[model samples]
Target chain A: MYRQDEVKEASFFDTGEGLVFSYGPQHPGTGHFRLIVRVIGDTVLSAEPDPGFVHRGEEKLCEYKTWITNIPHLERPAILDAAGMLYPYCLAVEKLMGVEPPLRARYIRPIVAELNRIGSHFYYFALYGVFLGLTTPFMWAFGDREFVVDLVQFIGGQRITHSYFVPGGVRNDVPKRVPSGLVKQFRAWYRDATGRSPSSDELTDDFQKYVLRVMEFLDARLDHYWDLMLNNALFMDRTVNVGKLTAEEAAKLGVVGVTLRATGIKRDVRIDEPYDAYGEFKFDVPVRTEGDSYARAVVAFEEMRQSIRIITQAVEGLPDGPVKNKQHPVNIRVPAGEAIARAEAAHGESVYYVRSDGTDRPYRVRMLTASFRNLIVIPYLSRGAKLAEIPAIYWSQNVWPVEWDR
Target chain B: MSESKIGYIVNELKQALGESIKEVKIDKKMTKITVEKDALVRAASVLKGLGFDHVKGVTGIDLIALKPPEDSFEVMYHAGSYSVQELANIIVTIATRIPRNNPEVPSLTSIWPSCEYHERETYEMFGIIFSGHPNLKRLLLPEWWSDAPPLRKDYRPPGR
Candidate 1:
């Protein structure tokens, strides 16, 4: 609806002699966000991040929904990693209700969550490929992501936006093997495709075995990913030393996840404060010192491998116990107290502060997502970046527009 | 391990703010320090000196609709550290309450620059003006938002 005359007359875009323009609300790199940039020649003088196209008032809406019903709405901000979004809220509400999940449920939480982490990272790489104009990796990454999503669906029921996590624990127990009907269907399909009937031991339908098979397939695929994208000469030219954020600046700006880890900061909520089953697993927090787009890409890539490691460990060491706390009712009323819960989501740290006045509905629920904290980097780094480098910097920071706007 | 960390921060806060601190609640999970409105900046500066360099969040609670009508807005700064290994697991809250009718508090952006956007969002949501905030305009709301601050208890949503 904006006209040229209105934009020209707007004082906010008037940066004296510099020309101003909106980067995107529709551009794929912007992700339903617009960055208003003022440029003199080819260098960006200033950038004002304009997010909120998808603002849904998540905090206010939480007050209207009860404890059990808010899970679906709360996970809408980061739909790609819905389990990550709900992980902290469940923990916070559990603390208020004074209930703890069983040991088996604790281990299952991370298994499903890491599957989501791997899936989310694959999606990120897919979008990053689109940003850089690479078609093969875009298709390859998305196609590879389906394996992780299928495993998620095997447990959580839906592909994405799985409202599977509840306050005291998960919704149900993890099934050990595929159903008989599906197993027969899979064997018949394999016979048709490969011209031979599948053997019993050749392709097992056990849940843990299936998950490990996917992880092994991806472990080999990541090497091919490096050959196709990360190590390519064109990617290096576009990413290296561009939009460089030093460690000092990153810490000052409070960037998190890969963006902060790329600056050599060893800060991770999973490692710092182990919530749920994170303490029971052994994994490394990948760090990169370059503080550039390439470093961020590498960090995210390495994290996917670590997620695979965590998933494998969780599945192998899962203890046998009850899944959910049957003592807690569906409409659990929280006590009159406040609690803060943080989790290392696929993106970064997500902090949820919940205040309860002895009611079924929370008095206040404040969520500070990693994307919201990372939004500050756009205005800070785009101050003097080249015009062509804007997309590289923007996608590398990985700010989810809807998450931040909420 | 976390208990000692909480104890250390609580001691530092007590030594730094002294009488200016209204209350200090030390729990196994977190440490909360409520300071007078006038001593907010000083309390934050003291915490910053203790290596709580960046803020995790800035939250505002509107207590106008309470049973006794507290008639105040409580603004809390959840601060954490990355440089100090011991303080990494701890989140120390620095909170101050201001009058609801004329809500104003000094912005902590000057102390922790990461608090800039968090403060802006809080201001836009609760109508609690941070007097010294550099950019205090709306960050999430529309440009034409003329209604009461949406997060305030009295400002009901449509069809409510």
Candidate 2:
């Protein structure tokens, strides 16, 4: 069933170089999508992605829901990163209806968004390690991530799908005891895992230092799995320069986040178009000019560090106020008009364009997700790469099908 | 750009398109501009020349139940450019209302290739035919599936 010829016909691959194969829809490496690859002997020729298996008609569903009711529904698409996904939609709706959230709500939103980002990055790291054949890192990263999830549950009343963010404010306030508890857990986790306390000041240091520590720990264990895992002689030999996408191609496709940064575009919606508390944070948008599988890995690691920096600043400088604005009922009507809102998610930028015609429900709701934009790059980058390197390239790209299909 | 500048840009576009521009109205938050079906491509060309390169999203709104003399549909093409950050949040929608029986509009795919999938999606869900679309297959729906246009105001699910 896993043979190359059978997989080839069932998938979509480039028609040149060697026989590039596809593994997906049910492949272990691909989270929840299908991959079509063109292989030139052991090398990859090109990769074309075929997604949409999990399409739930989310945008269409929004048209049937009231403005407030849609909050919980929106979290279902990307359950693991609820705050990041819903905040932009809430912001857009607020902007459209002329509702301004209080200062306290703004700070709380960022706090939750950062915590969600931490959990998401850890999830990514765990998945990345798992795909690279390093089970220990996967276990360790997931174990640490659970602590953050616990904090979310404590404040939001639910772990993954918190629907905590609303148009005018968050559903509830961060519990008084929650912040200190998280800080304690973070400290203990850092010391136990690394065998040394990350200086209290160091936790608040430049984003790079925090990232360097995490990468250093991962790097120290590198030799144990080198040829057998991530940088294995076989893995590097197959992936080093394969699936290359130059900066020009990335920009043309409007690929944002790490994929675009990997091509040296330096386009981060957070930095380029700051929203929420992002403008106040100091962090670098990591870029790599290599535009290959290895470069993508480096970009992801660097981004994890930047996220940590943003979160630290948010927690330390968090202000006080209601997390949401006082507003009319959740079923309040919106005047007839259209508005588009977007935010930088872990994968890339997710955009939502909503149209309301003086009604309780929206006239139309269109979502252009990050995964949809990033998926286009696969076909372009996969060209001229070998077959055996398919999984490595796919995993490195961090394509999440649920986000794409929804 | 100030709110006045955005107004100026809209006025400039209206004047440049002349009679091709049907209706241009600025809502509280966003601006709405409608054009004739025949002049849609030409108007898009003018907008592109004025620096609206990226098509952020293409949205279709079904107005079947409004039951106007001409059963109406509104399709919006939200365009923006990064060079003009102020204009980034300003969405210029080019809408057209076609007859419900024959909802065929000229394809913008030739002008903006990125709109191909978006238009196809509209075509599948709302049954709005883009006359010159290169590949007009169903996107989110299965090819063998049969159902009324899902996004239409009159589209009722099987049980309901």
Candidate 3:
């Protein structure tokens, strides 16, 4: 926005090589992460992801905190998908402690997890829309995500950073009554999300029926997402063939989530490991062969539907019993052993490897987040693309900086 | 017990590299194998030939003070597969130990390119040098701060 001479007088003009641009540690799209891009003309030659700007030394800090207090402390990285981020740690701790959560806890955990996944994907879409300079999807996405967040807040006391998961089970059972009217209201809002009612099915009375109703409601909204974002001419023009990756390249870089799925690998932790209630759920892992920015968006949008279907199945199959095992959150000890737990976070496989020394505190903890795994591919994908295509490719892969920095 | 996929992989590993394989242990969740430090690349190559394609994580544990004086710096490469359905779920940890005073192991990026980033992170976190990693630089830590590897047992964070 300033004069062209003011920009030219800076240190960049003296380097005498290709134009070097540093895209933010502060830009709206960068989100506390910096990108050092070396561009020639309008095309980028190399893009180095300069992370650790938001690094809190979380692994270092985990050693200082007690085992019980670290539950909430670990959730600080990926706040939007708080349950998904903390899910692995709980499973690893439970494994080390030699205890298992009850059946009721297992079923209810996935129901809430799918809700959190939907909310996280919605947040990604909102930011994706903002990055593309589209205001409608940004506006529409925020409104739609409130339904899932409200469901989360009703289960836990807070919105994000819900430290609801414990070593034995969830913090508490779902409320005795799911407040039938609220689900119906969300269903009604989702059913007519296109400003016209697409489904004419009447709502049933019980919670299982209510679950099916909400799934049908969100299923209808998927059509509009396809028509607006996925099939839009402008979005297709910008992202279709940009940032293309082969399945071989994806596997080599260890990219996960929609980034890996778009490259034609159908390896979701839900499908592979089948932990928690995922084994009982019937859902498809959406994958695409194109391996482009557009394909990644399509995969993410399709995953929302799969999540909806999974949530519906989980709630319908919700068992009745105690939510937690006998282990209390405060008074617990782990045996001297090592265990690894993997959960499908919003980004990708959130894996935690823990070692305990027959004590209450963990002796060693290693968290391999999806963001850090995918960070290696940034310099590869942005290698030959245009300068402006950087954000389109990066954000479309669902990169979360806090998770990377953690 | 011999029919499970993990058990079969463990057996195959032992059969293929019998002389170099010092120890092999199998649990319900994972398979662990220890090899000589110089034979690390050979074992990794045998693994790659067997279709265990990618490296999931690289972990370095300093047994300098945790165990007896003879204990060394132990590094484990959790290699697994993504393409082969039978081997996809198995996480085979190939372990090797080096002298604590000089920790250097051949980089696995030649066998599995996915370990490039994991090795770089391990190098910075534990100060264990991987000999042939292409761009071995500080990944998570800042450039100028050359303190002790933060994750090592003896190095405490500032103000701790």
**Which prediction has the highest lDDT against the true structure?**
1
lDDT of 3: 0.78
TM-score of 1: 0.94
Worst 10 residues of 2 chain A by lDDT: A1-10
Error of 2 at B160 (Å): 4.0
lDDT of 2 by residue, A1-406 (tens): 0124424332344354356455676855534666665564554544556666677778778877888888888877778888867977887787788877887777667667766776776676567666756566577667666766776786688988998988888788766544444455566656655678877766533332343343434333323333343455655665578667776555445565667678876666676656777788898989899988777766876776676667666666778766766676577777766777778777777777777777788777777766666665665554444455555666677666777667
Q: What is the DockQ of each candidate?
A: 0.50, 0.31, 0.34
Query: Each prediction's Cα lDDT score?
Result: 0.84, 0.68, 0.78
Give the per-residue lDDT digits (tens) of candidate 1, residues A1-406: 1123423223344457898899887855635888898887777777788887889999999888888889999999988888889999999988877788888889989988888888888888888877878768888888778777877888988888888899888998887886556555555544543456646775587877656655666777788889888999988898898778888878777788899999999998888999888988899999999999999999999999999999989988989988898855568777878888899889899999988877788889999999999998877777667788888888888768888888
Clashes of 3: 0
Greater-lDDT candidate between 1 and 3 = 1
Interface C-alpha RMSD, model 3: 5.1
Over B5-33, each residue of candidate 1 has an lDDT whose tens digit, in order, gives 67777787788878988988776435688
TM-score of candidate 3 on Cα atoms, chains taken together = 0.91
Error of 1 at A359 (Å): 0.8
lDDT (tens digit, per residue) of candidate 3 on A1-406? 1123423223243345767778888955635888888877777766788887787878878777777888887988888888888888988887777788899899888887888888889888888878888768887778777767766776777777788888888998776445767755665585466355434344544445555665676777768778878888988888999889898878767778899899998888888878887888899999999999999998999999999989888877789999988765586777877777778988888777777666667777778787778887777777767788887888988888888778
Relative to the true structure, candidate 2 reaches a TM of 0.82
Clashing pairs in 1: none
